[model samples]
Target: MSTPTGFMEYQRELPADRDPLERIKDWQEFHKHFSDEQLKTQGARCMDCGTPYCHTGIELAGSVSGCPVNNLIPEWNNLIYRGLWREALDRLHKTNNFPEFTGRVCPAPCEGSCTVGLIGDAVTIKTIEQAIIDRGFDEGWVVPQPPKVRTGKRVAVVGSGPAGMATAAQLNKAGHTVTVYERADRIGGLLTYGIPTMKLEKHVVQRRVDLMEAEGIEFVTNTEIGKDITANELVENFDAVVLCGGSTRARDVQMEGRDLNGVHMAMDYLNGTIKSYLDSNLEDGNYISAKDKNVIVIGGGDTGSDCVATALRHGCKSVTQFGTHAKAPLERDSINNPWPQFPNVYTLDYAHEEAKALFGEDPRAFSVLTKKFVGDGNGNLKELHTVQIERTVDETGRKIYSEIPGTEKVWPADLVFIAVGFEGPETPIIEQLGLAQDKRSNVKARYGKYVTSVDKVFAAGDMRRGQSLVVWAINEGREAAREVDKYLMGASMLP
Candidate 1:
């Protein structure tokens, strides 16, 4: 360890974000960075336990526990503590293909499993991680180093999200000709549209895409497999194929008056706003606007949070989010949620902070169930009806939600965005390839061995495992590339 008493000597600290009220006026990343000395002090807090759980990368209690990409947490922390940023950046890149993206947007399960968090706050792993990569970019340490030789093999990766990008990067490193197909007009699938600029700027994604392009990975946008090009043609044109199309098909709420004109899917709103913002700085009026409207977001996940933030930027009059589950506790429930498992705790995320700054309180309503959407006489959404619910366990151990009598209420809602989550991958590609599906309708490809029933065809990321973290998607992509390399050359050198 760099400092034996570092964990005890320092308390956890994070860089201050831009003032919430001020940042809401425009679309820019809000997070600030720490000074070099401050970062070194923060890095010294790593405990470097004999059994480091931070990089175990396992699922516990149905939630991710550590860095799913298995990033070498301790090594980089120590390097940063010793004032070796380039070395720390090198160590960080050993596992993750894109640290800048994850550092900005990842939930950082690594900190949750940190040994220091057992008694105190976890080390500032995420901050230090972002710092290392950002420094690398500024210092020109990160550059394209293409393979010197070609293997005379070709691979086609469908989808240009994190998973597809990682898969293409690794396979190209093995000297194979790689082509990535993105259905959207731009690369970076969900990264380009699903995420708003405040969290991750679009240029960060485009920068990586540029580096990958320079490394000889072909990216073909505005072309969708099974439509613009047949699946059979892709299979015939390439030596092998890997499907990284994420789980789309947003899960929707089935309720009365569902056909209102003001009701829309969360992705549609986010995608449109981001596209317009990038295209013309929101001057095009091509996206759904929440100005002077009462917006209600129906889900409590990250997507819902983004919707809330986006609405605030659009000068919405008021906003509220609904969740079916109870509010999380202030601290971890040791009995139900123990060490190493991700803690289900309550804290104000960025959007919540912004909303509180403007609205005087948090905007989430927990344990509330929506009963129906009440529309205006002309079929535009006007309000929503809901009832409070309580949880109970039956004799058979099944969970049930019982509606409380006298708790029915109605709230004005000019626009409603459903962010309930996704069901699975879209059907067109799956059906065209005649791929087998699991019970969840995800592609039936085993975890480590990403082989499908069809020969020379593989699957990874959300399409294979359903909606999950981007870090896990990177993990699957890297492993799938290894397997594909083995299949092609009768052996593999990828890790």
Candidate 2:
């Protein structure tokens, strides 16, 4: 257990972030490093609650309340407080295969459910989690521990994102021959391109890929399952196959003028920038430049937030974001979204904070809807016709998006990005594999048992469960690996 009076003796202090004004000028990470002592102090804040709900990994009101990977939060925290870095890393790795990635990108529900959060600020769970893994890497404690003997059962994993990586890692550890296929030019499906470099630097992702490659995992990039390589070939060649293709079909806007030249989907724009930035920072002529242009991002979620930040860095003249629902409150609403569950509170993420500092105000305009895109005669986006919306709960307790009266507004836009979220996994792979799909178009796979309708095949991650956090993907991937192992060897010794 941690020190009894630790919570009272210390306050939660996170790593300091760079000034927004300066950070927006480049694509480097914003946060400065925190010393081991400071992180240890924060880790000690973990209370000795009889039930440390932080690691429960349970679903409440349709959202997760704790660590989805079921990380031994308190155990690691106590170890960190005692300066047992290796022990903490061991505990962390027991549950999650990729703490470094989650530590950076995960929107930590664990922190939201911390017991300390009830009275004061939550423990710096994310910071401590990152610190542990970072120290492990720096100390050269993290390295490939390949299986002593190979199971000789070949496994094909489709997609190289979090789910596929986790599945490959766990299965390979169980001594299975695993090969991951990625359609993109590089490995790491979304991690390589979907996410901005500023949010999660490319090198951090590549480091893990490099490590995985060294551990006997075969990674085939620029190879689509259904296109470059036939689905039938993969199914027949491998003893078992797992589909971890993440949801990539962008949810599109059906309004008029949406096909204009300056209008683009968030992922397309983000991926293009990633490809171009690495090559020549738009000198490659493949990236859509937002420089000196009025930019409008439709959506206020993480994807939209990323779009805003990317545009600002590209030197966009102005940035404005519109959400289809009411603006979130500045703090937690105890009545609707209580503690222990991931609170649906309106919190300013890094991008919003930077935008506020640079633009003199938050770039978000909530409860707003884009009625249509207005394009110039030559097929370039010119402006956005928008309206405000009112959110009300119906008698059935379902929230309804109703348009507010007389709130039509016109906003100039040189470039527009639609970040409404993903619909489901792309249809080509599903069609090629002849896999059944749920109502939401996600691949139909039973939870806990990741078996798809097809025999000797499995599915996990966003492809199985729709858009979710990286932790859930890790959880699903681990669970799927256990099932796969059982299928391959008729029993699984994996946790």
Candidate 3:
């Protein structure tokens, strides 16, 4: 679109990152910035296809194929290419409430569905996106704009994570009074605690919250909804109550030595570290210390990888990540997963690379199942017994795994972190509200229509969708805000 250039002729590129070892020594973002000219070149790479599946944001063939928020990718790309940065930022902000967060942490499903990536590399969409928002911030173009009129309708959002924040912002923009309640000492939920600072600095999250506060959105921290403030109180005080509380009840590995002293959930470990860092530094020992310890992280998802990186930063002696499923292939795995959808492929993210540099080997062990944890006399975890396994599809084509006989062995470990993922939202609030739930324990609500069974009550984000990414959470929150506005006003202008 920029110059009618031939597709696939230009190479894909991304901004440079800090040296791995240097970045691991501290908990700060490691990505370097691209010049305005460089970002324009990247924006020029977008093919602007006829169908433009990148912005379609549809689920096809059982996986997400594009940006779930349905961002206007080509329009913004063309804007950036022509140096209309303010217009590009406005267009971007229209759909994504916080591109700064997504630009930093989102997995970028849009790139995965890019027509160009079907053959060669995808457009540098994520990098270009980050550049645009960062430029907007640096140029002082991003500012707080509180609504001119008030609907006098009050709304309560029960979590200050991405979903809650977006919901509050949209509702506030629609001239409703919005109050966000966060259980943590800080406003952000997992964004402030579960995610390590190296990936996303807390100060960046604080900046957005500050802006929201300036925009007439109220935030209440260190207040649990069901415990400190009753759900009934919220319903009575606010015109509508929208639950954006995340799915944070962690799943545990019920095995021998699970009650041992050194065993901890990934959220607990991550939150402890963040609390310690915020309180002062690690010297106070308020957080779980991996220093001089052999850490064995269970599960191979992003949480496990985060544990590996956090341990390394704490100066751990050794770190290992165990996975029950076989390693994904470097290329597309078409037999199990199809094309034009998210392909199950191996990717070396930042954490894995950090572990490799620190230990001289990648920390992940594929197809290795933990049988039990071995503990010392003091009830501290000492070793883990595991067996390598294979997986096969059942009659329903669901993936099932079984242990391979004669492969059992014990591995030494001083610290054991279970990063096996979350189950669903904590049931206390749901029960308190007397809302219906699905089989998975998630709050039951129709997609795109977030109204719950209870009158004037709505559920969105992980609370409604189970464990999901921040992007989806934001989408749910914004869409829920629209529905809530309509429910209260009989008609809605909010989007």
What is the lDDT for 371 in model 3? 90
Query: lDDT by residue for model 1 over 1-495, one digit each (tens)?
Result: 879999999989999999999999999999999999999899889878899999999999899998999999999989988999899998999999999999999999999999898888988989999999999999999999899999999999999999999999999999999999999989998888898999999999999999999999999999989899998899999999999999989999888988999999999999999999988999999999999999999999999999999999999999999999899999999899988898899989899999999999999999999999998899899999999999999999899999999999999999999999999999888898899999999999999999998988999999999999889989999999999999999999999
* Pairwise TM-score winner, candidates 1 and 2: 1
lDDT of each prediction vs. the true structure?
Answer: 0.94, 0.90, 0.88
Ten residues in sequence with the least summed lDDT for candidate 3: 1-10
The alpha-carbon deviation from the true structure for residue 47 of candidate 2, after best TM-score superposition, in angstroms, is 0.9
* Tens digit per residue, CA lDDT, model 3, 247-319: 9899999988899988999888888998899878776789888999999999889899999989999999999
Instruction: Report the CA-based lDDT of candidate 3 relative to the real structure.
Output: 0.88
Q: In model 1, what lDDT does residue 440 have?
A: 98
Candidate with top TM-score is 1
Flag the better candidate by lDDT, 1 or 2: 1
Query: Can you write out model 2's per-residue Cα lDDT over 367-467, one digit (the tens) per residue?
Result: 89899988889998899898888888889998888887899999999999999989999887788879999999999999999998888889999999999
| TM-score against truth, every candidate | 0.99, 0.98, 0.98
Per-residue lDDT of 158 in model 2:
97
**Considering every candidate listed, which one attains the maximal lDDT?**
1
Q: Which ten residues in a row have the lowest lDDT in candidate 1?
A: 188-197
lDDT for position 189 in model 2: 78
Q: In model 3, what are the clashing residue pairs, if there are any?
A: none
The regions of model 2 sitting more than 4 angstroms off are none
Best-first order by TM-score: 1, 2, 3
